[model samples]
Target: MLAKIIQEGLLNHGFHILETRTIQYGTQIRLLEGAIINVYRTPKVLVQGKSISASPEQLRKNLEYVLPTRITVWNLM
Candidate 1:
């Protein structure tokens, strides 16, 4: 869906999109230093390293899994 949006946006701006694809997963993953590609993050990845910011979804999922019930309950909404 995001790729389609991006491609359509590019086409609207007179740019061409050579390809489009989508990836769905059920596990959390992080981006490395040089790899700048990301589709989505899952709900099972733990984040405790220095470069903790991967994506909002990944961060929220981890927080909900590790945090106390009080904190997790609010963000879940």
Candidate 2:
């Protein structure tokens, strides 16, 4: 239920849901371009080149505290 709420909140905030990746550690919610959110025992979102560590209360706030940067780095192969 918490995940659903967070997903909905992110959606409302104009954050494009790219894909979800699951690993041995936890779940990663991929967002616009390269923004990746790691939600494990604690929540840490990686955007641009920085990572924002968030609390449960902060997560409930629709990620208002997270200020993500653009995904400028790309693979030109």
Candidate 3:
């Protein structure tokens, strides 16, 4: 799954992961230095004040999600 790929990717990049735990919504990876990453099992996205929630498989197809060391977000139209 994409989540596992990201987990491995972060591990390869020298991220000190404090914990990997599952909450009610999804899995959360706690890193050192008070940073946390959430890979939602079911991602809920809000676009233009509308809530859109879906399963991982569904979101994977409809969304293009990425995680990088530097934050860069683009609103694709």
**Highest TM-score against the true fold, candidate:** 3
How many residue pairs clash per model?
Answer: 0, 0, 0
Ranking by lDDT: 3, 2, 1
Error of 3 at 38 (Å): 1.1
lDDT of each: 0.33, 0.47, 0.47
> Of 1 and 3, which scores higher on lDDT?
3
Provide TM-scores for the models: 0.27, 0.48, 0.52
Candidate 2 vs 3: which has more TM-score? 3
User: So what's the TM-score on candidate 1?
Assistant: 0.27
Which residue runs of candidate 2 sit more than 4 Å off their true CA positions?
A: 42-77
Candidate 2 per-residue lDDT over residues 17-76, each given as its tens digit: 777667455566776533456544333333231223443343334345333223112211
Residue clash pairs of candidate 2: none
Backbone clashes counted, model 2: 0
